[model samples]
Target chain A: MEDVYMGIDVGSISTKGVIITKENKILSSEYIWTEGNPIGAVKKLVRLLEKQFDKENYRIVATGTTGSARKLVGTVLSATVVKNEITAHAVGTTTFHPDVRTILEIGGQDSKIILVENGVAVDYAMNTLCAAGTGAFLSSQSARLGIPVEDMGEIAVKSQHPTQIAARCTVFAESDLVHKIQVGHTKEDIVAGLCQAVVGNYLNNVGKGKKIQSPVVFQGGVSKNIGVVKAFENQLGCPIIVDPDGHLMGAIGAAILARRNKERRVFNFDVEDMEFITREINCGGCPNNCEIICVYRNGEMIDSWGNRCERGDVAARKAANPNAAAV
Target chain B: MDEIRMPKAEYNHHEMVVGIPRSLLYFRYGVLWERFFQELGVKTITSAPTNLKIMTNGSRRAASEMCLAMKIYMGHVESLIGKCDYILVPRILDFGLRRVMCVNFEALPDVVSNIFFESPIRVLSYNIDVSKKLDERRAMVEMAVSMGFSHGKSNKAYKKARKAQNEADSRAVKQNEAKYKNDGITLVLAGHSYILEDEYIGKPIMQYLNENGVNVVRADLVDRKAALRESERLSPTLKWELSREIVGSLVMHVHDFDGVVLLSVYPCALDSMVNDMMLRKNRITHVPILQMTLDAQTGTAGVETRLESFLDILKMRKEVEAGNGREAEA
Candidate 1:
């Protein structure tokens, strides 16, 4: 049977899954909202992919997970590789566009800029302590403007002149947006202005000090917005390449990582029915009060972490399995 | 009859325990203080390392605009309340002109006192304002004298403590020098000692790097005299004492490190300006730089991602130079 790989990206806003062959060809893909429930989201995502995947023609040999909740989802899927989103995104993007020198990503609550040299990420930075110039910022503004986030991109591109708004912070942006609306700026212009603000904030914050070379690729959830894409293009004075599968790049990268990993394990869609429960406990064994997270599979303790000392480890294990002998 | 023979009650110096907050200048002078007290036959207690409860208490007590370091310091001070006889809060204004510390250091004692004015916690302090010709040894001696120690005894204890502190510092500097001989990816972690040594903020980053097989070098662990000289030559106008030391270390060891990680706490004006200047003035062509500004809300995941990607970049670069760039994918 042909060897295949599975990858899942469980992010704060969305869950994505993909099946790919050794040659990096996508056999099947699925994307859905996480809706604050990562386990349920992955189960739904995997089931969707299972329907599209050709099980008879290919055998899934490896699996990988990426994004914020990668560890939780990795355990759920028994992934062979659990990589961070930055490395995953870089690998995924470089695989497709080997010559790409810059990768700009704007996701739900975060944004990052990665500078690539010869297909390797040399330097990078992420938006710190603020969600000012991310997809979440746009969605919130979209709500205030009585316009859907998906529609804002279309409306933005139609503006003749985009009004300037303070993009230093979300609070400042919100007040400036309200002031502009009170002064009667057109909806399209305001929407376009918001997109510009995001680009400006991103550059001033995450993209600060980094050299932005040519062959730039923009991805993540925000890449779907044409308005922001145009804003990036205008600001950087270079053509921004947005792949059709840009949003799935994280999951695709994960799949590539699984393919590259030396370890091999048979991955099956049967995980859709496995009961995965995550329990967070404030371990009081020490003053650190580490919030240990334990993942239980079918009422059996699978894995646990976040304890600083052996006392915490024992406490977590004891909390999960009281009947088991103490270590 | 045996109890009746124990007629004379001797005065115990160990009863007056001085509580030292494990933050700010403690990282700089902790050994000195501990050794001084030990030499004087007095007992001392240091507040525990930064933890969730301490950080939360500090953030609640400090002003909204204060840097995270300051807030955490306040929390450490709060943790020592009622735990010891007196809490030590030193007003370290400056070592000398152009070697001045952050203004927060000058106000730390007063800030702690004012924040806990209603509480029954009494603050014990020493002044290190060199502009007024006051020095650390003299201040420490006077503090000890006020605590009922003889002038000569306090002076001798201070000298011994200073010597002990110097030896410990030299050991650290030597350890850093020895790490340079190791054949691996050496990254210079540049930050204030308070930020780098804190158990809550910096330890995990160091732990992660150590686990990943990277040779970690601390920028602040260099010889202060050498570092100061390098700092003066690099940036004559640079004023802050700690910033000068950091700049000097970075300048002196720039060639040895494969990469530099500029770690700073959130909203620290000194670090913000110093780091920006360093980034702009950095002339090294090959060394990759990563700036991580952490705050109360910073999670380990974000930091891990950055660090992992950084290691990848270094590995990929090394592979490319060796004509085996393909192995970077593994």
Candidate 2:
């Protein structure tokens, strides 16, 4: 039977799943909105991917998880290889495009520029604090303009005289956009200008002080917008490569990592229908008072985190022996 | 009712005590600080000794990319929030004379205020421009005036406090000078004295080296005048006052010391750039220099291992040199 590897990218905004064959051929993939529920999103994604799997030919061997929710999803799915987003993305991208120099990734809430040299990520910069160039920022602006976010790119292409908007921050960008609209700028021009602002903001902030070389691949949610892609191409004076499966690159990367790690461990996709109860408790050990989260399974404490120190061990121990005397 | 004396005019009793975390500028302006606050009649509270809890808490509160010292400073500020009416987190722009602090120090007050917004501790600040004659004296007077102290009282207090602080610092400098006069492998540590005094960060390394029979000399322990002079020999263009002093001490005592350890906080942009330049440009053939960056996550075990290996290398080199000297004598 052909071996199948499972990869899960559990990001803040969405959870992605992919099943790939031994030869790195993507067999099945699914994207599900996290909806603030990672566990539910994973379950839904797994079910969708399982439906598309060739059950007669493929046998699941290993699993991998990446992104912000990697730890939680890894624990849930029993992933063999869990890696950070940077390593996973680098590995996944280099496997396909070995000579790729730069990887520009702009997602729902954050954006990152990874500088690759000789198939290794030498340095990288991420913009987490700013939201002006992010997908969420675009989505909100789309709503204000009474335009569907899906059609933002198409509308941007129609703009001949795009309005100039301040892209320093989300607040400044929003006010600038509003002022431009009030001054009777065409919707196409405004939308196109917004896309340009995102590209400009991203370059000025995330791409500062870095040598950005050619053969650049722009992936993640924002890569779907052709306007931004054109902006990058024009600004860098280099062609921007956008894969058809660019949105699923993170999931694809996770799958590639899983396939690489499958030699060590075997995986089964039959997720146990176990209910997990998560609770948040405040740890008042110091003035900082970090609020810790404890996860319980079947009336027993399984895992706990959020407290910055071992002071939260008391909460964990208390959860373990509820009938015992309190500390 | 007929003899009700006019109630004393309700004096604005808005007395606020500002707490300054004694980690960064505390060593630099110990005298100036005491005098400035004393002149204004404002109570000052400093955080307790640096401990593991403070370090951990500070790291958690700070952004992932902040330097190690700033994180510790945050923890110190967090400790002082409820204990004091206001935290005297002064935003220093420039010291004039082309001397400037790290960008992190300039943004510290703003960052701290934003980070701990839930806490009701007020921040006090003063802008210093020596070029405009707005010196430390003017800064203290301005701070005092803002705090409702009369200009005359603030000036008097500033003078007295400045005198007291200078006297105390000179004594410390003298003590350190005496300590360095001993016959031993004097390792001159060129870094902030607070970093050396910090329990979780610098104190451990100092204690470990001392226990291993190595005499530790602090670059910050030297006289300011002598250090400045020494620094001129090392780098004529070294603009940072603190870094100049450290480099100056290293140049003067490089031959006297067995090895030099240039300690820096993690993610420190200015220090990393300057220290890297110093390590590359200086050709001190006799002494080996170790560049170590301390962060919140830095474990003592890792530090101990590095120190042990460096010491071993130095010992082996010394032994080989001694053997050659004996052979030459024969």
Candidate 3:
């Protein structure tokens, strides 16, 4: 039987799953909206991927998880390899594109620029505080412009003269874009300007104090935008490569990481009949009353988080064993 | 009609109890702390001394950017919240005697209040600025008056507390002096002794180094005159007494030690910036320097590894220099 590895990228916006053969061929993949429920999304993703591939043909060996929801998913799935997004992204991109020197990733909420030296990530910067150069920003702007988000790239391509928008911050860029539109700039010109502003903002904020060299691989959801890709190439004076499976790179990275780990664990992909429930509680430990989230399986509290103390741990343990004395 | 009875003014008679976290100013003014409340006829409850549990608790609640001391202090405060009626978290802006703590220290009460807004425990605070003739006595008197004590009684309490605090501080200074004179690689640790004394946060690092045969010296252990003079050499314009003392101690003893370890708490904006500047400007090329940031969640494993690596680097440099000297002689 052929061996298969499982990779899960449990992000805030979406949860992605990928099943790969021993030789790293993508056998089955699925993406599902998280909808603020990471556990539910992972369960759905696992069920979807399992349906596409025959369990008999490929024996599951190892599992890896990445992204913001990586820990939650990993805990739920019992993943063999749990890694940060940086390591997973670098591993995934480098495996496919060995000669790639840089990776520019702009996701739904965050943007990051990873500098690779001989396929190793030497330095990387992530913009977690701002939302200026992200997919959410673009989608909101597209809605404001009365254009479908999917049509933004194609419309931007039609501009004869693109207007220059401020790319300092989201507030500044929005006002600048609105001002440019008010001054009677064409919709296409404004769209093109918006694309340019995103690239500029990313380069200035996330890509600050770092050298961004080419053979750059632009991945993440925003990489689907040809307008943004063209802006990156124009600004950096270098060709940008966007993988056809760029949206699934994090998942792909996770898959590759799972394969690399020698530990083999049999994964029971039979998630169809699994019962899971989530509950939220407030921990009044100190002045910071942290709202804790607890996940239960078969009426047994499996995991709890959100509280910044041992309170969560005690609560989870107590919930699991009702007779246990409270700490 | 029944006659209503009010609460008695005697300290022993009072049912209301105040809790004090002995982490930050607790180190600086423990005697004054106990004395002031005692004189005011109020019961004071202090959190247990710094321990592993407190450190772990603090680290979990504090943000990633907060300094180790603040994190530990928060932990201490957390321990006292439910156990006491009110936590005495004074906001000492300035000493009025040219000594001012970091802005973070000044804003600690506000930070604690904001961080623990949901907690039922009340926080009692008083602002002190000696530069504006706002001395400790005046501050204590004001605190007492606010708590419903009469002006004459508050004044008496303040004087008594002040006297007790001075004696305690002097005794602590003497003990530290004795501890400083021991044999081995004498390191003059330059931060607040309170931070250095915390068992879980700062003390373990010192204990580890000492157990490895390196003698520990505290910046707080040195004579005030000598440390001040040494600080003048490093930076003539250095103002804060504690910082100046540390810098002075480093300058004076940099040649005597093999290496220097500068320990700072996380989110300490003043120390982070000033200490980095000191490390850059100092011309002590022969000695190695290690800057460690302490937070509530400081893993002993990581710190141990760093300390081991730093020590190895110094050892390697020494061996190389010694070999070079022998080769030149031959």
lDDT of 3: 0.74
- Candidate 3 ranges beyond 4 A from true positions: A35-37, A164-179, A283-290, A298-300, A307-311, A320-327, B1-330
Q: For residues A1-327, could you state the per-residue lDDT of candidate 2 as single tens digits?
A: 877788888877878888887677889988878988887788788888888988888788888888767766777776877766655676678667889989998888768787666665544656633456888889889998999988999999999987898888778888888989998999999999999998998987767556789899998888999988888887899999998877677777777777665254566556646665677777677654556667666666677766545777775666567667363
Per-residue CA lDDT of candidate 1, range B84-130, in tens?
A: 76688888888886898999988877788888878767677878888
Alpha carbon deviation, residue A27, candidate 2 (Å): 1.9
The lDDT of model 2 is 0.73
List ranges where model 1 is wrong by over 4 Å. Answer: A325-327, B1-15, B145-150, B283-286, B328-330
Q: Assess the local accuracy of residue B284 in candidate 3 as a C-alpha lDDT between 0 and 100.
A: 41
Q: 1 or 3, which is superior by DockQ?
A: 1
Candidate 2: chain B TM-score against the reference chain B: 0.87
Return the interface RMSD of model 1. 2.4
Cα distance off (Å), candidate 3, residue B250: 15
Better of 1 and 2 by lDDT: 1
Interface RMSD of every predicted model, in angstroms = 2.4, 15.7, 13.2
Q: Which candidate has the top score in lDDT?
A: 1
Model 3 chain A: worst 10 consecutive residues (lDDT sum): A121-130
